[model samples]
Target: MPVNLADQLKQQALAQGFAVAGVASTSAGGRMPLRTAALERWLAAGYQADMAWMNNPKRLAVQQLLPGVRSLLAVGLNYYVDQQQGVGVARIARYGWGRDYHRLIEQRLKRLGRWLELQQPDSRWRVCVDTAPLLDKAWAEEAGIGWIGKNGNLISQSHGSWLLLGHLLTTCELTPDAPAIPLCGSCNDCLPACPTGAIAEPFVVDSRRCIAFHSIENRDDTLPLPLHGWVAGCDLCQEVCPWNKHHAKASTDPELQPRNWILQSKPQELKEWDDNQWDEALRSSALRRIKPQMWRRNLGCL
Candidate 1:
C-alpha cells in the first residue's frame, strides 16, 4: 500500500483555486485536549451565546465525522479584497462582501476529493466545509497551511488570515507536512481592537459580547449597545492584526470581490429594504444569512 500522492494532490488543489494546500496525518482518536477543554470551558461559561450547535460532542472528535479517516487534505482560499467601502455604509464582514464562501470552497474541495478518489478508487472520503464537525483550523495548522492566529483565524504567512478553509478526509495516506509554527510571540493587538471585546483571551472568543454574533447569529429583540457601525459582521480584530495589515493582498478571484451594492449601502437604505429587495440583493452572497429582521435590527442599532 505504498502511496505518494501528496505532492500531486496539493498541485491539483492549487489548480482548483485553493490558495494553499497541504496534507496531515490524522490522529486515531482525533481529539486535541487543549481544544476540547477550551471548548468545554467556553460552553460551560455560556460563552457560545445562542449558538447551540457548538455543544455537539462530534466537534471534539473528527473521528465521529468520518470514521476510519486517515489523512486530511486541508485547503485555504484567500478572500481578501482591497476595495474601499463607504465609511458611512453599514459594514459587511470581509467574507460576506461577495459570493457565498461555503459554495466557493465546497465546490473546489469536492473537485479535489474527486481527484483523490480517482487516484485511489478504494479510498473513502468526506468533504468538510465550514459547517462540518471537523476542526478545520487545527487540521489546517497541522497541515502547515497556516497557524491559528490569536484572533482564532487560520493565518497564512503568505496570505494573512483572510482565508476560507475546507478539508477532505480520506482513508488514503499521504505524506504529512510539518505543523505550522505560530509567529505571534507577543503581539496582542487584536485583543483590544474588538469593539465589544469578543476576544476573551489569545485564542478564545466570547460570543456573548461579540458584535458579529449579535449582528448575524443573535435573534433577540434587543442587542448590546455600541455595534460600532457593523450591521452584518465585524472585522475589527482582523483589521488590527499586523500580519493582515502588512502582508494581506487583494484576492485575485473576481468572485470574491465586494459587490457594488454593499460598497455603497447606507444604513437608512438597508433599513428601508423590503424582504424582496433583501432577497434580490443577497441572492448569491453569504450575507443572506442575515434575515430581514436581523438586518433592520442591526441597522437600527447603527
Candidate 2:
C-alpha cells in the first residue's frame, strides 16, 4: 500500500517518542532568509557571548550542506516537569533535570533516519541535535512544531516552550507544513521575568547577561552578575510565560522526568561534593558540562 511520505515519516517520528513533528522546506525564502539575516545581526551585535561557535558558516548553509536535500523534518519532545527545587538547593533548569537530552534525541533521530532509508533506499539524511550547525529553533518553527516565543525558546501551542528540539535534513523532498505563526502578541510577561535583563529586547536574548549562559558557559574567576539561587540553568522566563504557566503539560517521558539526585541536592551540597559524587550526579547528564570547578564557582557566586 502506497502512503504519503511526509505523513508516514511524521508518524514514525511520533512513534519514536517525539511529541510533535512536521516537515519544512529547505528552499530559498519562506523564513530561511529572514532567519539567517536575523542571525547575522545578532552575531554583529556580539550577542552570542563566549560561544563563538555561532559563527559557523554551515549554520546558514543547511541547504547546501547535503546535495539534493530539499526538506527538513523537525521534531520536538516535551520535557516539562512540575517539580520545583526547594530553597537553598541548586536551581537547575527543567531541561537539565534528567539525563542528557543530546544522547536521547540522537538515538531517536538515528532510528528515524533508519526508517527513512528503509522507505527510500537511495535517500540521504542528516541527524542533528544541539551541537549541529543549524538554526534549529527557526527550522522547528518553519516546520509548524511551534512558534519562537519572545523568550527565545520554541513555544508549542500544545506544550509551550518546554520542548527539546532536533531535526533531520533529508533528500526525500517530503511535503512541507505551514510555518507556525507568532501568537505572543502584546504579551510581555517574559521580558521582566528575566533577572539579569538578558531579554535585552523581545525575541533577543543577550547571552552575556543570561543567568543560564553564565552559569553553564562562563568560566571566569568570578561571575559578573548575581545568581538568585541558580547554580545550573535558570527557568524564570519560561516559568512566567502565560503559555507555559497555563498550557504546559507535564511530560510523562521517563527519560525527561526530574532525577532524585537533582531533587535532593542543595547548593552547599554541590559545593562540598567529592570527585566521585560529582561524577555520579552528572554522569551521562547534560549538566556534566558544569565541571567540578564550575560547581564551586557557581556556588561561590551565590
Candidate 3:
C-alpha cells in the first residue's frame, strides 16, 4: 500500500479511539541502537533483577516476533488521568487502576486486523500487544507514536508518557514512518523523580530499581525491602514529566474505571480481606496479576 494509504489507516485508528499510531517496516527490525546495547549492559550488571524474561535474546529483536513480517502498525492508547490515588493508600499503577489492557488492546487490534484483511484479503498479519516477544517500545518509537523516555517508557507528544501500545504486523509492503524524535533533549526530571533511581540513565531504566517490576513481575512473596510500598505499577516518572502539564486526564472507559470499593478502601481495610474477597474486589481490574497474598504483602508496607 502507498504511504498515504498507511497514513489514512492511522487516521482511522485515531477515529477508533487510539491516542497515537504509526507504521514501521518489520523487514528492518533489529536491536535498536543505543538502547539495545544499554539493555545488555544493564542485564550484565544484574539490573534486570529476577525478571529473567526481559533478557530473552529473541524479544530484544523485532524480526523474531514473526517471520516474513514486513510492516508494523503500532497503536498507542492514552491511559493518563488526573485522579490520584489517595495518600496512605498503596498506589496501583494507573494503567492497572482500571481493566486489563491486554484484553482491551487485543480486542481492538483484532478488529483492526479484520478491517485490514478486508482491504487485502491475501495478506498475512499478526496482532501484538504486550503478550508478544518483541521490542515493542522500539517499534513504537520507529513508528513515530512516541519517543522512549529516560524512564524507558514511550512518551507521546499529546499524552506525555501515559499510554498503552499495540500493533499489527503484515507481510504486505507499506510505507514506513520516520521514527519520532526524542523530546527529552535536556530533561532530567524523570531520572530524579524515581524513588528507587530506576531511571539510572537517560533512556535506560534499571529494572532492579523499577517499582513496576517489584509490584507486578516479582512473583516472590516478599517485595524487595526497598519497593514494598508500591502496590502495583508505578507512575512516578510519568507524573513528573513537564509535557504532562498540558495533557488532559483521559476520560474513563467503562471497563477501565476502578470499582467503588477499590477507590475507597483504606490500606487497613484491604489487609482484612482474604483471598476470595481480594478476587471479588479485583474481578475487573488487572491487580489480579498479583495474588491476594501479594496484595497483603504490599499493604503491609503501609
Cα TM-score per model: 0.96, 0.97, 0.92
Each candidate structure's count of clashing pairs: 0, 0, 1
Which rank order by TM-score, best down to worst?
2, 1, 3
**Candidate 3 Cα lDDT to native:** 0.77
lDDT of 1 at 118: 89
Q: Using TM-score as the measure, which candidate wins? A: 2
Instruction: Compose the digit string of candidate 2's lDDT tens values, residues 1-302.
Output: 13499999999999988989999989887888999999999999999999999999999989666778888899998898777777667778888988799999999999999999898898999998979888999999999999998999999998889889999889888889999999999999999989899998999999999999999999887888998888899999999998987889887788888888688787777778887888887888999998888888888888
Please list all clashing residue pairs in model 2, or write none if there are none: none
Candidate structures ordered by lDDT, highest first: 2, 1, 3
lDDT of 1 by residue, 13-84 (tens): 999888899998887433356667777887899998888888888888877888888888999989998797
lDDT of 2: 0.89
Model 3, range 1-302, lDDT digits (tens) per residue? 55476877788788777888898876534336655776678789888788777788877666676677788899987776556667667677778877788888888888777777787787778888886867788889988888887778888888887788999887777788888998988888888888888877787788777888877777777766565456777777877888776664575566666656655677778889988898887775667788888777777765
Best by lDDT: 2
The C-alpha stretches of model 3 lying farther than 4 A from their native spots are: 1-3, 29-33
